[model samples]
Target: MIHVAIIGQGLVALHFEVGLEKLKNNEIPDYGVPLRNWLPYKYDDIEIVASYDVDESKVGKTVYELAKRDYPGNHIPGSLKDIVVSRGIHLNSMKGLPFKARGREEDKGIEAAINELVDEWRSLNIDVLINIMTTEPVEPVGNAGEIERRALNGDLTASQTYAYAATLYSAKYRPVAFVNAIPSPIANDPGFIKLCSERRCVVFGDDGSTGATPFTADLLEHMYERNRKVIDIAQFNIGGNTDFLALNLPERNIMKKKTKSAIVEDILGYDAPNYIRPTGYLEPLGDKKFVAMIVEYYSFGEFKDEFYVVMRINDSPALAGLLVDLSRIGRIALDRQAYGSIYEVNAFYMKRPGPPGSKAVSKYHAFQGLLNWLGISDPRMQQARR
Candidate 1:
């Protein structure tokens, strides 16, 4: 069984908690969860051992209460009612946001904060640390020296501190994986990458690829494969979730835009004039975000073809499903002693995967690649062939 610890107790984490509850009870839903074999392990193989959050309202509340409060209709397992939320480091993650976030670091020093988390991981036997925190406006620390320097001064972001704590915990105790789900650049940052490798902890992320981003990536790869000259592309998502609310800050939004826009140049072999980003926050939309895209490319004989489409999807559940895959894969990587980031898994599930500059592949190809890395066969693909 994979024991998981989460950094943020937001919607994605809650959805993940609820989903696991459903799986444990054998009450599988017909839709929502897209991945079938989290492979070699089923959903029931996963467990939420501990969780952290900076929201004062959510702190001290059990995972069950948090899930039920947000999604009252869903039946959360009684088991989760025992898991209480712990205080987390906030850093600048709450800047420009409406709500005030509190971190334990305010009362305790940085070393104490790290030690506390390390103690928690050891006690909880956390095999994987999932970071689903809100997007932060980070200044992009590029090297290990800078990471250490900033961390000493308490200038590091919340995600960075959690990652550092995970690394320390891994080195002193057992192996662990830090699955980053936001655009804080932990996996992509050279500093953290080297630290994870040296410390024997696996890392995956930079950003979780869900909804509009992955779809656009596949579409871009299709255009490239078809030898179509892409003139330009525009894709954006408007959501009501706290993540989108956090992105309303220009600096934070730019970080997200960088991840969303990185795929075009990598996939197409050259950069095209494009605008791909999270455009706005519409609170009424809630977790279901409105996504719109327009791709204009040159077809045969310089004929311009424009493709426009729009749709709405629940952003949290898609990410939660991907987290499930990452958590299981992380445990598998730990078993194999595959320290550092796994590009194969990242390419499939993350928008801007770690080890930087890796080209984005189509969703189908990425899935096969991920399965290959895990040394497992795709049962769904096999049945389709038959």
Candidate 2:
């Protein structure tokens, strides 16, 4: 079995845990899972063995209990009860927001905190660690030595702490993969990449591409392929989730902007005047976020054309589906000992695919590349050819 550990027991984590169990039990169809049965590891082979969180309300609870609280009308899988939310290294990730939170680092110190978590992971035989944490502001530690130093000295953020511990776990026990589903720059940081490469582990991410960003990417691709001169682009997302609340802060908000805005230049081969990021948070809207984007581009003969898109995206569940694919892929990478970030894996799923200067292509191209990496052909194309 692919034993999985979640870094944050938030809505996305809850959704992933519950959804995976339901998929295993044949209670729910794998509608959102992108690769589905095509992967070498089946859905039932994945298990949620552990979860970590800093919130007082979540720490002592079972995944089942949290699921029931967060998803009132939905059916939560009983398998979730076996997994309890454990305290993690907080580093004030939820400090500005309203969650009474604390971390293991607070009680045991950073060294002990990291060692303890690695020891726990060793005990659990965790193969993959999925980080769906609150968006925290962090810059790339360009120097690999600095990453090691900060991790040892406790100058890192919460997500970085967890990532550092995962590296330690890999060094001591076995190979592991870390999927950073938030905008924490784990995959993008040159230092982290070098460390992971040396340590014999894999890390995928820098903010997942779930909503308007991917759509904008594909649209930008269309314009570029047709040789359309793009004038300007403006896209923004608003939601009621805790992530949105966290993004309301300028520091956290800029991280999302950096991840989202990179696509325009990467896809179009030039920078476009763009304002793309999470705009606001309304509690009543909950996980279903509103997205609005407008693109103005020049067609042939200098004809100006514009298009506007409005969507109500269920922010958490969309990302939750992505975690399913990431989990299995992480497990797959562990077998191959693919130390460091896989650009093909990250390009399709991550808003900012790592290794520093990697370009963000449209999901259409990324998907084809992803399938090539997986050594799987598109079945529909085969059928069409036949």
The residue-by-residue lDDT of candidate 1 on 1-386, one tens digit each, is: 89999999999998888877886687876254545654677777888888999898899999989877896355677898978999988776787788768888888887788788899889989999999998987755878777877776788989988888888899999999999989888888888888889999999987899998888888888898999999998888999999989888898899899889998998889899999999999999999999899999999899999899899999898888778778888888999999988899888888888876577677778888887887777776779999
Per-residue lDDT for 1-386 in model 2, tens only? 99999998898987888888888888889987889899989987888899999999999899889988986348787778899999988888897998899998888899988999999999999999999989998888787788778987999888987888888889889999999999999999888888888887899998889988888899999999999999998888889989999999999999999999999999999998989988898998999999988989999899999999999988888898999999999988888888899999999999999978999999999999999998999999899999
* Model 1 CA lDDT for position 194: 87
Deviating ranges (above 4 Å) for candidate 2: none
Best by TM-score: 2
Q: After superposition, how far is residue 386 of candidate 2 from its true place, in Å?
A: 1.2
Q: Highest lDDT among the candidates is held by which one?
A: 2
